[model samples]
Target: MGLGLFRMFNCFSSKPREIPIILGSETPPRPKQRQRKEELGGGGESKIGGILGRPYVDINTMYEMKKELGRGQSGVTYLCIERSTGREYACKTIARGKLVRKEEIEDVRREIMILQHLSGQPNIVEFRGAYEDRQNVHVVMELCSGGELFDRIIDKGTYSEREAARLMRQIVTVVHVCHFMGVIHRDLKPENFLLASKGSLAPLKATDFGVSVFIEQESQSHMNPIHRRRRQTEANKACQHTVQQNQRRPRRKALTDINELYRLERELGRGQFGVTYLCTEKATGRQYACKSIARRKVTRKNEMDDVKREIMILQHLTGQPNIVEFKGAYEDRQHVHLVMELCRGGELFDRIIARGSYSEREAASICRQIVNVVHVCHFMGVMHRDLKPENFLLVSRDHNAPLKATDFGLSVFIEEDKVYKEIVGSAYYVAPEVLKRNYGKEIDVWSAGVILYILLSGVPPFWGETEKQIFDAILEGKLDLESAPWPSISAAAKDLIRKMLAYEPKKRITASAALEHPWMKEGGEASDKPIDNAVLSRMKQFRAMNKMKKLALKVIAQNLSEEEIKGLKQMFNNMDTDRSGTITFEELKSGLSRLGSKLSETEIRQLMDAADVDKNGTIDYYEFITATMHRHKLEKEENLYKAFQYFDKDSSGYITRDELRHALTEYQMGDEATIDEVIDDVDTDKDGKINYEEFVAMMRKGTLDNEGVIGKERTR
Candidate 1:
């Protein structure tokens, strides 16, 4: 019976490994080549056969080089094509210099290995192959015809919440995959992300893994010792001097320790502990804000340990949207620098100071984001003990873009059962337990509560004249909800703040639990609206049709006679197949197909949805025309949105005058015109109101008649 069972198992396994049997001759016959006359069927011997085993090309053969695409610290990148295959590739060749250290060389090789392992992933740069010469090592990679995402953000000013969120999701997914494979991309920033050529809003790839590291699970412990010793030595030297002292000292001859001062640019900001500067990555000219902390001043061993721990924590907390990305940490003799994504909008503190104060709803929106970020951090076993308005940075004006929580200098990692007794965080936001030197992750929750309170009330819940008084007020835990200034504060919000600011750390609500509170979950009731997916999809399709319409309009504008151009508007009006003031998907798709350039249904939908601000079922003539023109303009080059946004100057859902005047002074019909003329000429409505559609129509007509009115094209 046992023999039979074993035989059954073997039979089941054998079926899985089955291969097709080949039944053929025992020995395969080899074909013999004929003489040149027979081979060429021309009665002449060929030399090709004689050269079969010889080298076909010289090793140092030079090909025609094109424009230099970009450059980096160690190498230069060029747009090149293979002579034999005519395939385009990005050739990155390292320069011979001491700056290209042995470790960095190893890093490049490791990057190659990582790229090779992740070659087929959709959001990673595909590595072709590598070549080494006497002086330089050349790495050939996929040429991303689409430009960098950093450029797009700069040109457009900033991304909308939805766009930023979507992009973050893609980035996090890539990071997730990398971490799962034990490969850490030590350098991850906006400059390293590249868009695909096929779609404007397609997923971006995480590139430039030159500083990446891969460690086995078991060997990770062994590697920490070497890193720690290096950190100690660097810390010792940094402590022995100040920035001025270090600057005056003799520079190291070693390229790695030379401190590439040429790369540094203007100082962005400085704090008590560190300074940040806006610097260009030498190779790509991509700008980055490098935040440098002087290790000399951070003399305490525990504090140094905290900094190192923060780096490790950031590496593990890759997918959280609200946290500012931590690109690798670098330690030199003078400073220990932590490079982060440069949020150009600056801090929430600046915005608050500029605006005076945010509305209750706006504050609530920010509070929700704060809660989400803190919750994500706590869930990952890390606590951001310092939660203040200064630490929250606005990435964009769109209320939805995740507010980046920065400054993890005081962060701590704790297990579920572990309790921390270190007193940390700002005095104003510190928890009552923290004053007693008995704190845990709940201290972070309390600090977050303080931020939420300030956001809503524009003041701290507990205020006093001094630090002692503040601690006393915190201990009392009396929530003054009935005060004159707190009239507008909702009961739910007050309840949340009270729970989060509980005197006992154990009684305080956890970040995750606080996120589910009624105040946050149900706060969107005021802005709630049903989403019509079908209508939205149709509108998106209409936007896709804009490309064809735009080209047609441009051709008519440039080539047609005045009389013909004048008649073109009527023709365009008639071309609106749906008669809903806009062209429909079917009409546009059918029309384009006749020109032998048909857009797929998916493409049409994506374009339409991307352009449609309103979830309306149809697009009007002006909307259709503008969308088409914008699509075509973006197709050819960058900064499409910079010009496109001007068309919507009124900040209304559509474009109108008034809207055009807000965008362009030339379109200002004249302040002397009566309201009636404004209604008649610019407003489609007979009710004397000039809507966006009417304004856009008038502006389009005016622009058609004028030339060189708009300023020179600015490349952002």
Candidate 2:
């Protein structure tokens, strides 16, 4: 009977006099919506909703307006029945177009943004989505069929202390989580709360965010200082633009043929859906990576669906600091082009390897950044699903640079308490619950725990000679804090790892909660110490494993579930070329070379020998995957250095104005004044040239692409 039930009263002493009220009080009839200002071409209403200039529709396609739910000054709410689900939802229709005030339009936009921001919260009314057309905007949300808190209260007349107390607690808890997420519910009343279903045990949800606001306030309390600083900066910026503000958005050009707009320098890497390349924009001569996806090659409907899903996800996640910025996407006859931020510093694995010996402090630093990204994703109800060293990218080569999470192909939107049955993600990093086919977003936490274990001990807690054995170890989730590394590592680090790697999903530490763990605290005293030889030796064991054994593990892991092997099958088929269900050495070599891997004869032979598991001349699909899947992150790091070398024409360890001009000449950036301007923006030490670190920061796209901030990194 806690506050989650949304009860109205606590005790007889504190109970208020109930004002008699009917549940569905209809309002006095008003005139119909001022003549339909503009009707879409397809008839009375749009078929679907569209944002900006996208295609839109009227509610009729999927929903039938049954009756009026409620009304406000500028909008009316109706009970809408979805055609497919046959479920009732509250649809709010706001009159827009020429008759609406600009402020009202912005207010509606803000409310929609807030709903989208916290979409899947259990105690918040679910925002299905919004649709817009020429005349009115339609917002679809979960209909609380159980009706209002006030209606229930007035009907019951009064309630006992237990009932009222339980209701109050639920409302307060909802508000607490909202405030924690930066939203301030300006208007809080019993009328705003509703029951999820008809019953005393049902949960209470707070709806109507039209008056709620996201407040930008600086933090002075206990939290991650780094995050606090970011919030403080946001507050300061908000203050600067307290009144009217206008900003021009960048112009994005559409191109059907990618070759006409950009020059492919080299293949970056390939994923299940597409191969990415390092390319230069023909007009600007600026380096960017374009992912080329073959339309015909895509087999499954989900893979095809993922293309649009990934694009939409990237577009929404663009402006976040720890999310790879989306440049834009273009499509032609055969392929789709996804232009994105080119992170030259490479993956987190490469950064760790480059350091050779890493500090616990440094690992914590990277973990903190990763945790920040996880928090952001969770706030938006997004689950990355895959969290591994390879998925995280260092923003720059600088010591204090941030980490960004990329690759949303495997990511999905999840609501609270819902479990996903699909067993996907890399075997080494997957949670035990994932294998069980019953898991929620906490699966991401277990994956992160594996990553943290590798970071601190340089080896995973769950691993074996075979995939089944590895699965056994992960299921056991047994931690050996007394092992070679634990004797040298701190108790705090061991404790946090244990908590995160907890066998039970409920006990596992959440990404948000983990940020406050002792190990992540300022002087919470984990090791600031050096590399322990025992840990290093164990790490070496991982690297020193025979190629054949690793290949065996990869092959077995890929076949765990049917879904896991779908992408591999497609890739294998594509590589087979002759549709023979197997690939020969020549096919392998050609494919590898096109992907930008320079292999000598000796190396190529060694690779062919490793994956020819049956001692056969040609490799089958499973063997092919096992061979190609064993890619090292170091290759990506090598590409980053090649990019730096391209900009450092003289190999002088720094880039000069001439080098910059030469690199960016196509965009009319070769002018002496423009070259100087670019250099001055990134020249941190008041130096006339840009070093590798400064160059990296300058190259980071999106919010951090600000010239003034890059110049101030070390100068101030």
Candidate 3:
């Protein structure tokens, strides 16, 4: 045995007296020539020392045990505070009664030995000491407050490929280091890996070694108390046999013509580079979705790589519980046809919208499936950078149909130690770290978190009028957990959301950890209580309302009493900042931040543009007041009549197309196309003109306004 082997068995016998373990500087005495055989071969009982057979030492005399932190299958972990230094640590108490078999007792000794051997290494939790008494065995170690890997996985949002790969790299490092140090960790999983602290970029620490063993012990059957040598050999042989069988199996040749196997039907959907069509297999009549990528559209080399990578990833991820099954891939002169499972249940949001009265439980169920996709993808060594509601589909029209993830166009293989900088993903679902260009797989969790927020509240947590505004909101806006529906939402749900949406990638919850969250877990803390109807209204459409409704709201805002508009006026004055009687771009940004606003700078600019009725670059008091007025205020009968009068210039009880055009042109809010769209959206009776009732209904009811409505009033 070398110096490393000596360091592993430094513990002394408990026969005489217990010796203190000095972590940093302890060096065992060198073995004499005569005693070297006994130490290296390890045949006698003294060879193992007092690993579990230690004389009773009262652990309570040194450490004060507090509340129970967690309970596992083997032991209960408590928050242990050292009496002398008042330093906190975790104490796992394993009852002596549980060690019924001799093998169990020996395994415990090996675990303690391995932990001591691997101590002082980065990413492995620091072991303080192990103590034994008559009733139980106590193991003390570093307190990891950042929570479990599985906890954050289901708890939070989506992740980018780079972020997921970063997390995976950390996990792989722990395994690599363990193997290098002559120990094999048999129980390495997400739950075993924990963050050292609660900080975003906290180091991941391997906290368990119960089933770990030294390589020498595994190789030598006589030295191994469990006699695992034969078992290990059999396992290796079985793996090799499986590999040989797979190699001997006949492989299918690539199909050049998809038309020969399947008959293409109606087009299901179309994208920028490809078209998805419903196809029927000629032999079996099984329906599948065939996505044909036009070769011409993939002009760039990177774009072509993206297409090929997507096909490969889909094939690689086939048979996953939450991923769509890839049927086959075909190539022709014109296009590349990739076939997969056809999900008849449609998109995730579509099901939610159709459900009518949604609840936290249902949202949790959906989010669990979404995060599972992230977990599965990351585990398979693929990073799905683009994760949004549209990418998910239900397997069938059944109410309890299983959800599946589709589309891998932006996905990539997780390369070790690689720093990914390319910005990818939908604007609303992208993580902040992706924007910073140093992200990892955690970006998927962040995106999933955004989807959760939308699922719970019926709209995205970060709302904006444009892509730039959405990115700004992602970078700067605070997550809103106090708005309308949020007050009624469960605390557990909000806590998970906070962990998922953590600003730092290192701090953000992993997909496996998120899945273990209380709210995200199956039949866990998520409530069955119906969410507010307002959330459903907002989710249906987040864009600007019709131009007519906006003009009406503004008219109503102008007529408000002094008391009603007092707060609005003060807010406008405060935003003006320099007492300039108008709010400039810089002033508006600063003011919003001061007011605890979640709006980004770009969103503020959109608000400023919407409020500035005179088309000025800044927002004046009147414009600000009008733009900030709540929708309920526009519902008052007097206010509605006044606004209708403003548009119904002729007082003929109906506003004709000319009147609408004139009002819109006077405000410079629309042209021919906008006027037509507004009429097309708000004109319920199809009279091509608006009546008083119609105007009031437009003001009161929720409308999917696609054009020219002012900001804040339409979105918030």
Candidate 4:
């Protein structure tokens, strides 16, 4: 439905249990005699051997159950520690005995299929492996320790239109990729989106597509609701049929995953990456592209690691067509052989230039194809840091041929809260932030804007006799909308360009937002109407104010005295039924009733909706503090001091370094050294401990510098 421009690799994908090394070829296994069908998933009294590629082992031998991660109507997810490796994974235990309906079984199968297919995708939370017990099915997956996305947005001082655009772009791109894979995510609300980890600009991930479809069974018009409904019914029926049809399984020897069946045909291309050769499978005589990279040619360890990572990324994206399909990989003493789908047609620009005098409609059409590939890449958490036209290839010489993105040599998987400072990308398309040594995926959007501008006008947006002048113009961001043909360009098109070219990285429109612009919707056609001037003015004002308000909230939240937040946390814990450290609405109701106050379900929902800043369905300490601070009744300063005395343990009205250290670390405030530093800064008498008067003075921080209270000031 939209076009995508990249900000970076967009390659940050997820976990796997036994990630098969794609290289080092193995001989094809001899065919084994097929066994007679038995029962569901080879079921005969549920004697487990193996179903998927993984071997069945004692589940208890592998993982040590830590604590509950989450609970739903059908299952409970535990934070498990792998006994031998000490690696953490999420293990979902779904009680089979609790399920009665055939639909429920089908649901389990559906979830398994979705996780299996989308396992290694970046934006989607990963599926490691699954095991079956006597009474339940246990599915293991990557445990995302990062908090939810909307929660960060609420608490970040650096929030802006650009920030919102970046996050939404991730969401939309993920949805876009899911659609391409024939999986329609039925539930995509804020609750389903999480940051891969904490801090700012973490990789946003999609999870819990509970009502999602793995594959569509019928074609229908997306614009028509009736046809869509009919398609839905067909898809559901197909899913049920698939589950019933696979009820019985036949045993057979597992074949080796190898590309030894293929024979080299001819050399296609050669570059710094590797030598590409045309190859064909001997059994089926199907064509393929094989990349042979000599190990000796790679001088650095990191470069060789990059080569290995590329193969892994390719294997993970095996079935997606937008990405070049990975067939297999093999390793010899001298080189690595990576096989893939061959694109006969050349670069996208090669066709665009050859066609000549193309209309705006054609430009939009071509741009849409590029967007689709980029959308998938971003959703997979891969940033194609380099996104010029040369990186994309047409499937064939045909005019209507689709394009696929390639050359992931520059791609890298980003983690949640990580910011890349590398200077990468072609000179013309690089974003301003990149030059400053601080940037994110937004670099791709800037590059895409350059592409779109050139596609529309057949000339570069900013140009000069030398590279320096060109870069200067880019940094200045002055576009000549009135220059020659631009005067005749559609206002919607011009408006989009202006938004994209905004000087401030914090204000630039995201690729997703750009796709939704009227110019994009019109397919490059001129719009008689422009965005309402007053509305536009109001939008500008709102964007500015929204940025400030979010930043202010973040500062206030961060600067809040730990004592104040601690009080709210106690109240939060009282309502936390499972002692999970977060309180859901049901728990809140029960907890509040126990405390002699009863609230209706509607009222409870309303409060949770307001207080659950992260939209993670539960309220943590931060959210609890944020919510309770605005309550009508306030805790007296004397009460806060008394609470401090309680932590003192000796009723001495003072806290030793060890006592304060234990308190702060337990509350997730800071480390031991940080707690010591904070106490020393507020000790007032050069003592090794913090007294009540000094603590109270530190809490009332309006009179002192930041060092007096928290040792350092928080800033965006």
Candidate 5:
């Protein structure tokens, strides 16, 4: 069987003695394999190894545990088959000896609660069921025969660029969903990510919420000051132990702490928050970094506040697509710990350092995702006061998901109309306003713009030997856009960066607005320009529709006199065909025909084209009235010109069509039919020509109807 087929079997066999070795399966030979797997397990075996030996879990009876699958710090995960359903499952069991403290039990329970709440999330690992027996708490999850992402990375070395982008996109989407719902996965790393298959398209799942917390909304009750202090006390101890352990341990070997049994792997890295270990989940034989905070580090008041605030911020920012997720937070006597989603692809900063720099397109793609994340935070009234390259970590090479934004140490909460006074963040990317201690979330935008500038140019816009010089350079707000390296940057990108790094906070473009910027447009294209004609037409249509609707309502409300009502009804009747009280397009066309203005067979199309803003064909009463008024305006203008022409009897200036026709009929020059035909023919250029030139000529004394007198006189 494949490695995936053997994953569940490893969970049920935790003890070093009890581990079932499969001859034909892909199990590694004892010593050589242990060295390779031990790094992921960190330095403790107590958490993973003892889980299988728990007396409460009847692994033999409940599940026919097969080959060992993987391990972790706290439990062993096995590939087991349910006899009744014959369904496959990955079962995790906590060993007895490893359960040294009450907090460990609480951590397990907390994970169960979190998983229950997150049951509907498809991207999250599916929780099957949990059982409590005499010896252990047995938690079962879906068997993703795909195995750990860490191993895949190892097998493949490094992923292709497309693969990395695809993975980042998927992971970011998952993180976004979690943030929307107010859940934060504080610990995000590679081993926490499990692949559902070995294929490139395999689904990635974020698991291990051993230290996650759900902050109740609208309540400060859960904010335990003393509890946090105590947690910090524990974290300090954990930090001291970790530092001491590191000093004594040799390179490439596992170290063990007396407090915990899990073998610690080499240190991945250290941060102000805590140290991360590449340890294995011994029970399941899975590798994961168990990030532990030493009790010595978090003892300060400010440090504890940072911890709590980070949790709060993560909880509030539940749906952001790019932020890293917090799996869970817990505490041992020596440490306050957080379990997280592990990204095997490593830090973005590291990648950039190794590769030197990314191309403009690659940089833009990364920046766009970051902008999206910042947008989410700003919309929710939160600020990630510290946004730097170090905080951006890649999940995979497919770029399926965005690089996860980690390290919320310096973040803050800002309510509406509130401004923050904290002077925090790395000196390199810090905005000028932040240095002056007058900054808000827009500072983050400025930092982001600076980062984008760096990504594209391989250097930041403002740099100095010291913090002060950097601040001065930022305040100067000068960019050498015309300089050698800078000149190559696209105008759109330069424009975006300038807007983002605007010196004045008020003038700085907001995150949502920045997303609409030309640089961020899909495929790096510019946004669509405005259509002037559409705008003007839409405005006129809106005003006319509103006015007509008001008038129609007033007429129906019995507020008008009967005479006025009759006049309004007449107007309505003129447009309403079939007398159905509603004006249909057919009725309107017929009415126009009576006035010598006939509509085309495509009249419906014309009406729709003129009246429908959203392009739905059917015109309501309001739309009908508005269209009619517009057409009426045109006709009224024509009539006024014709009347003026008729008054000018000489026809040198103007004459109405009526006067010319009358003159022709009276003189017997032409009868009604002939006069009508002549007038119609004379009205050239259409519009019932009654212009001054035509009117004066027609009215000149030349002919009379009775053959007796010829005069320019008005006849009744």
Candidate 6:
């Protein structure tokens, strides 16, 4: 009844076709598939229909297969012409050998059933029956030769908002029909929808029911009581929602601008999608971290969905221990501001590095907290797709501050029996199954295991010079348990790590089980002995190496020409809001906040201290320029050479201890230990001095050692 369903679905024509003249006439018995093949001089029948439970039907007799259309994980789609009607159609031939598991076979059967059930619906691909033969199952359906929706969109370069709305209406109609028919189309992406024809107004047809399932009451009853209620609630909410895509320029409810409620402060951190800020509530004066995602940045459908999902996840997981508290979400015209708990203690590794060295017991305690987060997340029916040290923050500056999982950008609700195919998360922490493109909630455990490995050994078990190399190492699975720190690590801790890092996702330890492990449990077997000092030294090599690089960047910033520092002058002026020609601590903080930083007060103070070269407690124009210059400027060979020359003041081609001391002292980081550590880390030849090549290498190394080489998120 919606959108004149009979007109929208061309296959549902009211005009009846003339009855076949031969319908009541005597008919010959259908020949067996094998006999037909023999009479046709074809090969013997193969036993591909063992699971289909029906005799094989020779599809070639009815349709002539032509050129291959495309291929999927387990099947190849081909263009075909029906012999009787001489009409074109698509034939998806799935090989029996590819459906190795019983579940896989069942998936094929379920998809056929779903297509059949949805055949007559608007925006759904028409079903032409499934035929199983000797080698494969052939599903013939309507041929959408207009190609994928994504391809068409790409060809069009950009679509008007009206066009996007029209397309979305078709998609939403499909979803609406699916839910009404008691079906769940789990894998809905741009590629899964195809245009019916090449015309501009061609209807879109949904395909790829490989991961779809029927919403059966029996299945809902099988879920755990807690999960059952949550799933039911979510399902009901999804079905009740209606898409108002056709309402052009619809009125929007007034939203409170985040600035009206909260006084935005200094920047905390910046990410791919948006910038985070330190915000204080006006009435209560209570500070919180606000992640303001620009609406423009989230232009894609998936990106907008991710932002909404993250907000929903944060709200759902709020009040859980070890999870960051969600204060509220405020959406304005420009941005969606998510106000969350202000974690002042900073990143997990930052705290650990500050402690210098920690005992095995301490490592166990930290690991326990991380695993507990996993436990809580899984129990709440959430899968935190991205889990790493940076995503974890301490709630306070206390020595034993509780760790809170702060980011849920890539997280999703745990869909029971669904195998996640999206490759996501940080490269170093990604699970083996994730790389294989089939994984579940167990990936969280693998990531936690990687963190524990770093906690114990001071380096990732999968070490490499590049992201690809790191992925190769992860796949290679060569864990170095006999190495330096590992040799000294307690047996019980190693045992726990082994279980958690098991190559098989099924074999890998569950978060609940890991929490119960002797090494992780309270009053457990973790020893109090301090981990090897080499481990701490290794940690510093990666964690604190950025200090020397920062000083070099400061030098480079000084030498930049007017053109090179073009916008910086204006930026500094903006930051010096008071027109004092110098930016005070508060002004700097507020300016960074406006620019979308969520840096804590202490971190902001540290930045101010670093940039205030003369220790005047404020940043002048030039000082602000130095601190704000981006690292990408160092990509220029000339800029690097000039920075190197600044440190090698004597023109000796080598930065000796005296020269290093001078530069570090100028930057207020001239401690003897720091100087030695810098040389030890950067001087590749074990020489006491840094050469031109060595300096370039040190400056080129990624700030977080092996981190960020794969960017903020690695997705496939």
Model 1 agreement with the true structure over 172-272: per-residue lDDT tens digits = 97797576544666667888888766466656877787655554444333234235333322112222212233233221211122134216678766543
lDDT of 5: 0.50
Which runs in model 1 stand beyond 4 Å of their true positions? 1-262, 397-401, 522-716
| lDDT tens digits by residue: candidate 3, 555-631 | 88778888777677777777777898888767877886786655543345445555566554566766676666655
Candidate 3: minimum summed lDDT over ten consecutive residues — where? 39-48
Off by over 4 Å in 2: 1-255, 522-524, 540-716
lDDT of 5 by residue, 78-116 (tens): 888865357788888766557776455444544655564
**Full-model lDDT for every candidate:** 0.50, 0.58, 0.66, 0.55, 0.50, 0.69
Task: Between candidates 2 and 3, name the one with more favorable TM-score.
Answer: 2
Would you estimate the TM-scores of all the predictions? Answer: 0.41, 0.47, 0.46, 0.40, 0.40, 0.51
Report the number of the highest-lDDT candidate.
6
Better of 2 and 4 by lDDT: 2
The top-ranked prediction according to TM-score is: 6
Ranking by lDDT: 6, 3, 2, 4, 5, 1
lDDT of 6 by residue, 140-187 (tens): 889998999989999989789999999999999899878765677877
- Kindly give the number of clashing pairs for every candidate: 12, 14, 40, 24, 130, 7
For model 4, how does the per-residue alpha-carbon lDDT over 432-468 read when each residue is reduced to its tens digit? 7765556665566677777777666655576642234
For model 6, the superposed segments whose C-alpha errors exceed 4 Å read 1-239, 242-253, 544-643, 646-680, 683-705, 709-716
Q: How many pairs of residues collide in model 6?
A: 7
* Alpha-carbon shift of residue 523 in model 4 (angstroms): 5.6
